[model samples]
Target: MPSPIAINPVSPSHSIFKKMSKSPTNLPASAASYLSAVSQADAHARARSLATTVTPTTTPPLSMSSSVTVFSDDNVLREGEPKMFDNDDGLSYPPIPPTSEQVFTTVHSEFGHCANEEYRFTSQHPPGKPVPHHKELDPPYYILLSTYISYMILICLGHLRDFFGKRLKPSAYTHLLPHNGYAPLNSDFDSFYTRRLKLRIDDCFSTPVTGVPGRTIICYDRETQDYNANLHTTGRRTRGLNISSYNYLGFAQARGGCADAVAEVISRYGVSCCGARLEGGSLDLHQTAERLIAQFVGQEDSIISSMGFATNSTIIPALVGKGCLIISDEFNHASIRFGVRLSGASVRTFKHNSMKSFENLLREVISQGQPKTHRPWKKILVIVEGLYSMEGSIVDLPKVLELKKKYKFFLFVDEAHSIGAMGAHGRGVAEYYGIDPRSIDILMGTFTKSFGAAGGYVAGKKNLMDHIRVRGHSGPYAEAMSPPVLTQVMASMASIMGVAPEPPKSANGTSSNTLIPYPGPAPAHMLPNWFDLPPSLKDGTEGLIRLRRLAFNARYLSRGLKKLGFITYGSDDSPIVPLMLFNPGKMCAFSRMMKQRATPIFTVVVAYPATPLVTSRVRFCLSAAHTKDDVDLILKACDEIGDWLDLKQGVGERWSLQEIMDRAVELVHMDID
Candidate 1:
């Protein structure tokens, strides 16, 4: 038998590949040569075949392959030449990065580990409705249109328009990916949708939502197979009780301060500033908005950006560079992961929300030092979220602050899903824990979810804001937050602050207030001295009433789901209610049944990439607008669906609130002394 081939484990800095950079002629005749199109597993099979083919002859010298070789047509582009290739192949290949020197590839150890479908997001499609195709005039439609115009000749001195919709709505096949797996050199394209229609998915995820995403709103039943795609829904004009939208505090309502501000700003600024923040896109409204958000969140200053995803992905690089370490929760959003990668900082992940894993990982990294170098890290940032959007779990802010104090590390928090929807004062995790917000070094959140606005904000000390303002990648390149969006956000903040004065009762043909104050000086801190209500806001009115109603609805939903024997994820205090179905097939069934029920329950069915493979879920966001009866209705329908599918496993054995609290407390104290 051939002697066992030995290859040392390689680091990114110096791989086993360097040793294989030998001439092709120098390799023994028995050496293996595999095609680049094949996966590492296939390559391994070929290697084994080659190993047995030689019958234990002297080992052949390994030779690296050249990626810069000529094409099949003998075409070769010189350096700096524009890329030219043929489309006749009809295959999309990973670009072979050109290099003069030979580049040897290695096999991955965990090649088939990703047999599960949760690895779907590695490809572009992920798990959702397909992106609509661009518009084009159909030839048949154009012919029919011309005939009508020519036959009648009743031209009304107006430009002709295409009545027929041209945007091709993708079917179920578009949502699927080819050759999905974990880390691998390549994939095997085995599964595909054949000409015969297999199982049909409704593909109505983008079914247009009209008016407010309140307790009840008008929704076009795209589930109707023959429904056409348009700005307005023509199918049945059905009203769905919405639990899917992330209008947590119910600020997205049409007759609110948020909507009013949007209208006023649109009339004044014409929608957009049409430039980057530095290029006059930012107005005084933007500055005022930032300052108000900072004060409300208890930060010295803050910076606002047009895109929420960019806030994390861009600011992280500005904060940390090489030689720094970023310890992040495994469940942190993809934006945070991308940010850490882009920052060039060494990243380590602990178990999701496990304080024990966190401290252990922190201890290990601090004791062992940086990878390869064993040198001390220049700075370390421990990043976490106030509330995980997927799991709906809350982070123990006090415990995290304690750990930060013990380790002397900076704490960066993403409150995107929590800020306006959490705490007694709607501040976030810090207030939820009754801990000072000042303990956190970097606070980032988005105005999109709870505030019903279209941007994100990063709040911290003045110096931190200044550093990001000058060095951050997000603001200089991307367009500034739209003026209307900024106004809406500012108005929302004031509503939370309770100084969004009640609009005068006037019969000016407007049910909603058109004019709103741009928010006055921070208004007093909401929880100053605890239970001390701000004078302007009565003890039980304005923002307080909304907060109370939302809290009650959250608890009602949580208890109801529990009673149904359906497993739910998230803290009792959180408005993000994720019902864990685990089975992907079940998730699809639950989603369809919920919508097609006697009373349609609109919800978000998240599978694979969003949650883990088996834990695919249908998440319901609570709103102040949801009544007790609404919660009961959802619980009843979900119970019926779960029972009909025989999904109840351990309803009677659900963990108690006290048990959860005790366990959390125990974990926090495990390594304290």
Candidate 2:
């Protein structure tokens, strides 16, 4: 059998072990078969590069000997390949070879005074932080089944390799395995890291797409360097329809009224705001944007930060401390979780959207009191998302509010995905449920997704916002939002709140509504039954129609996917929809299959670090600008993927477009008001 390791022309055994450590998957194919497959794939990639090359002159072949070493492709592992998990400081390495892409070492921030300190001081966040409050908050059953299976495969492969490599039994590597079958620490890092390692040369993350993220967009495929091209390779760039990106409300267009406002601001203020908010960055635009945001979200006041992630990450730490406890939904965004961790507060997670589980938690906490202390806790914060981005499910805000009343816990609602895409007036979850927005203690949102802008805000009572302004790290430390980004956000908010885009002047100089086209129009049949205005709503503008349209499309598409046999998650009325695809390989395979199709469907694949390794899925976000035809195209594309992947049931297999249309009509009840 051939050795599984890359032929390093160095110590072969050591090279074998090093390569093994970098395996993307734990599945162990026979060494000979694996090597053969790699050889053929490598040969094919080389042949493609050679075929594309226009060699003006030929060079003599270099001499080959036992001393000659062959490097693998950019994605393939070598003895000392670069990776995010690389622990080596690189100081010990030989002089680095020239490379195409810029490679640089990251210098971690170090404090000088600390190295010379004879002084003693104590911080609230000591290393061995809180003795974790047990599953007092987790679901009835917390399972890491896929992760466990993945680890077991790793162990088996290790043992098999040991046996093959002149070892009588499991070698010292076996000693590294967990004593019990189960690992104590539950982390998705290993799975996520390994997955990323395989995708080092893949364009699944953050592929640039032109136009708003709606029905269709032009996704760019940048020129990729040839596998063996040591420096740069001049490859052709291609563009395809993009169905990815989070421009939920159609505000991310390259040319529009809001875009014009952004351009104007960029010209006037230059690119950046130039400093943090508390320093020299504060502008009249910033103040105006904050005021408008507060008014839009029905808040007493609001504070802005340059990033959504930082807003949550920094604000949570400012709000709570050692004495407080944070009760978050199980599947809350990572930023929220990080902020919770940094706060030094005892955190408990309830089953997502489970009111009963949340109440049970409240009862348990109230009954048991604080851990180790048989005394009452200082403050308890209940955090949940208005609409979960991954699951596409809406939180039962009214019920949660009821519980908040019962438990007297302060409620923090993350409206990151809900603000401009939900509620009757798009005031978010509270408005969706016909409840008062002020009932929410802290209203947090981001402009990146819905507003097609950059930055986020924390809005609530005047006092709360004031405290965040003064105490939040973002206000004093982080750079303020760029002027153009700020203006874009402002214009987006204005448009959503019944303000129409200004009529464009025709060549004749008269205002022409014809030139100023209404950006989004909805399918009449897909509109929801509950879309009727209550007495409180005095008017419904073009903006209301757009929101309703988006809400309907999410439901419409979800129903279609489900009827066709594909497993999906999220509320029917939600814009965020996740189609569950379990196999680790299937995630990349599915994405590639869609992109290579005649009509490419651009999709974002989320696995491992973004979710539990077990819950890998392809998230599809619906936008108001996505026409029914676009949604239909996606449905058919997903159908083809299901067929190729051999997913559960038939899904889109048995039906033609006609059948799909029939089902969609029935499911959405097309004969609606």
Candidate 3:
């Protein structure tokens, strides 16, 4: 077997770069100057020399040494002191020239090359400071007024068009109108929002892409000749910087250890399990994954469901019944609402992420008891998402815990976005806030976000989980989670947890390991015998680095946008950053402009029903795979486009695009309410 190679942050040979090395004397003019700047005496001198001469080499050196130490590439000169370069447009390759001594092991498109350790940060709440609540910073009055006016205009125009089209072209309105005897399938009024407002920007949503949605994505180009009702593929493909996909930990890849494990599982186990868990479809893999999930979340036991939404929708009913009351956050996801409705339980909601409002509502509900009957409720369940999807805000768990102690209500935290994306150990919000995971009554999370796999898990006390396994609708109704997905989950999770060194063998040659602690390494016996992971993943080094990189990217982009004077929402450590574009027209404009940039950038825009009317905005999801240079590019693009769209309505002490890019680290560390 070949020896495992040790990859350094400064190594130059990355998968994205072509294998080419130049002698020191034969280096390009830009590369020569960059090297000269690296060895310069002072910061001012280095800046003066690099301003005009520094540019990334199109063909960088390929370092193959087992042990190589070299100056890191791009904006960062070393670990702490990061310098910005403006000479080259890093469309296809890195902008910084790499020395022959540098060797990077990751694929540039899937996992970016970021060697600067100073950029990394731990996503955790500051001890002394209070938890940050979701505070809405309203845009200028004109911006809000224009947003309302834009929606009004769209509605009026759509109604006018519908009236004229129905009379002039009856065939066009046939589906919306009555046929011979049957009533219209969908009334025109019911879908007014979709037909009029959403239809104009239909092209911006549900874009067809051909590759893994990692750092960059390849999108299929399509055109709609007559309105957005029909779209035709143009047979052209554009590779864009992806800020859209929910691949939070940047695990969505086609060529990693996780992918290899998934491929192996497919060949061994085939695809489907062919039946539900209660039937003959139960596999040993499901039980193994469930156990790992429980350990990962610091719970006693957990139940796995085939789908993320189903994990909430089907399991909630099993936990509560007709007499129970579900006090939920107003901004909870649709799945939570669906589950509550099906559970036959009474529901109440408070202002989103406002603990004071929640407490007041809780007091009223507890005092009032069941509606109409005014009798004591059987049980009260408080539900909230660890990370709200649309707003990019985190739940105030500490306050919720305090309230729980006083009020004695069950707590359920939906960590669909927070798991593997937040915290020092990738244990979700509980770890992020320094709270014990077991403190929360139930911890529900999905593998789709961070594990690069399908399905979801709900963890809690062993008895509760056992009951849910047998009683939940998913047990006998839904198809069992397939083998490939289970393998992907186990592989990715093991990489996060990491494998412990083999236990010491007794004189009789029998293993002598007894037990392991929570949040500790996974035992060898837990994984399948056929599983073989790479050294980096086996030791958990790559997983730790990815978590730090994601933290840096999240803070950098969120602070960068705010510094550039764009009204944004979310915590500084949140992976979801939403830049507000109040006008309804700007939603489509922003998405299109970003996609049509010199180096195409894909974005997700939320409007109308997804968010409040005036809060229509473009949401940018940061990933561990994005390098500092990638963030710089996004900031530069937004600065130029923000001015054109008149979207910089934020009131603050602002900085120029260049200054923000240069002082990214300082900005991320800035203390703000």
Candidate 4:
């Protein structure tokens, strides 16, 4: 393992401190009184000042550096005053109110104490002009002013330090503060998706213990070989894929060809990229992966990045400029919004999946007309996701493409949750609807979910890909996608593209040609063992079929819960089946009870920001991987938990399967229209 890098601590220069100590002009009488009151109220001021003297060898905490000290008037000694208390007695008389000269002198001294060596104070005003009233102040007043001034100076210096340190040389503390505000923060700080995903990390690592009769306790022993725990401890798990991950194909944990490919990468490149892509990055493996993605998606070129978030953030800004306009779906992923903001383009958001709203916005843009400004033609980009992560609803690509043709706007589709889960062969929503992949100016997807690796890729025309390579902000500054992992992603893509086998013949006398192979493993006992390809080549065909079955299972489960007198939201066609539990405290209790019964479930308790205070829910994601039996088991568990709570009945109305399917079809039509 490579040794960890050491970071140098920032130390305040003597000159900087000296400048900070310099006195400021007199504050208003009111402000002075307020400062005095504040000083009197803070009991720890003296102790804090004393604590500053004890400097540790390690870097000081930011809070410690920002802490303010309040000095008493007795601390100041004048040259010719009668000492009310002797120095020998360890007591001193309060010094006289500072004169203008004394104030200036004290300020100058404080300034000197706080400033860096490089900082020099030069007065803008002439020195002989009785230093304006604002220029000199009493010691007590000056002290209060100096504290705030010092704080501002420190903040500026910290920014300067970060700027120079990152732009000039490699530093151990480069991660402390960003050199530019736009630069990506540590991944953990920005993503709500990540927060939701972490809920299941503990489950994956849990182990069943032996010799515990009627009690299956989760083991945390080292011998259990909890891979997730090991990965987290060693910082090997760079990407997140928890309960919220849309592993439509169950590739994440399945012991198949995909896992084999991932293992091969681990054997070759170890775990991490170790450095950003621009510097000693861009390995052959990455290039191969990009090629595979481009071919699979029917795109001329592709550029892989660290994550889907970056792919959107980096690409949008690179394609659209100041004169351009971006027409985005209001419900698009947060990453797309951030990217559009960075583009410096005028943005207009259409109602979520509403074609009419999108057309209206486009018409308005068209009416604005070409200006005689620097850019002659007004450019427009339409942004939407192939599938909404939260809603599990597919985008109406054909309708969107028609609008794109009419408006002459570029179409960017984020296929993060759709790729490998839609289309005739799982090519994504565009292909699922039989829409030419070429119609999508840019299509982005992630490898962390269905592909069982970590990274993202943007597929588009050759020119766009070339432009991004040269001009994309994130390409040069941000770290490149990991190479080793790309190999696994590519391998998985190839496997998904491989010919699917035919489903086994049914035991019934009737023979059906519609049944397709299971694609992967399936139990022999499960009826309708064959997976049927959708009849139409339209976009979301595969997704529609899988979604339909998942929805059916969801509705079946919801109906079961309702039969047991529990309330649940969504119909058969909806991928997300939410069980309404009004109280958060009760929701948590219900979750515990479900776990005790060994039926794992997901819950999203309504809190201030996530949802309105009145509506809390136990959200269930219906995956293609989930068998009918799995859905039935979940329903059984819900009943147990609901009965325990005794408030299961009258929670909410249950949605019908037919009603949900009809609603989904309506939503799809709305997007197209």
User: All models: lDDT?
Assistant: 0.58, 0.60, 0.79, 0.49
Q: Write the per-residue lDDT of candidate 2 for residues 1-673, one digit (tens) a residue.
A: 3222211112222111111223233221332333343345445545667555332111111111112122333323233343112112111111122121211111110000011011111111122332121111111122235545754675576445545652554343344335458552423334335432343425555565433343345444543343211122123222233456677766666544556667676666778766433424487667767766777777768999899999999999999998788899999999999999999999999987778899999899878778898578789999999888988878877678878888899999999998888865667777676667888889999998888888899889998888888889898899877888887787666666643334567799865433111222211111212222221111234355556556656767876777667777766667887887755666767876776655456688887667775667798877765545556768878877787875544233344555776465455543221
**How far is 528's C-alpha from truth in model 3 (Å)?**
1.3
Ranking by lDDT: 3, 2, 1, 4
- Report the lDDT of model 1 for residue 109: 11
On TM-score, the stronger of 2 and 4 is 2
RMSD (Cα, Å) for all candidates, in order, is 31.2, 20.6, 10.1, 30.6
Quick one: best lDDT, which candidate? 3
lDDT of 1 by residue, 1-673 (tens): 3212111112112211121232223211110222232233234444556544322111111111213222322122333332221111111111222221212121111000111111111001112333222121122343335434532432232112111111243232333323255343322122211111112233435666555555555554442222222223234344446788877766675543355557766766677775323424467667767767887788888999899999999999999999999999999999999999999999999988888899999999999898898999999999999889888788866678888889999999999988877767777777666667888999999988878777798999999899999899987897777777787787667666665333455587434523222222234322111122224232224455456556656765665566455667765556887876654456556776776665566788876456664566778888765544456567667777877865554334454333433343232122211
Clashing pairs in 3: 11-102, 11-103, 12-102, 12-103, 56-95
Q: Given candidate 2, what's the lDDT at residue 438?
A: 84
Name the weakest run of 10 consecutive residues (lDDT summed) in model 4. 104-113
Which ranges in model 2 have alpha carbons more than 4 Å from their true place?
1-197, 200-203, 206-215, 220-234, 274-281, 500-541, 650-657, 662-666, 669-673
C-alpha RMSD (angstroms) for model 4 = 30.6
Better of 3 and 4 by TM-score: 3
lDDT of 3 by residue, 515-563 (tens): 4787787887778878898888999988888899899899999888888
In model 2, pairs of residues that clash are 392-570, 564-651
For candidate 1, give the lDDT: 0.58
User: What lDDT tens digits, residue by residue, belong to model 4 across residues 350-467?
Assistant: 8767677878877776776545553443678888987665544557666788887777878889888777765445677665565678878898998866566777889999988988
Per-residue lDDT for 541 in model 2? Answer: 46
Q: Ten consecutive residues with minimal summed lDDT in candidate 3? A: 2-11
Give the TM-scores of the predictions, in the order they appear.
Answer: 0.62, 0.65, 0.85, 0.51
Of candidates 3 and 2, the better by lDDT = 3
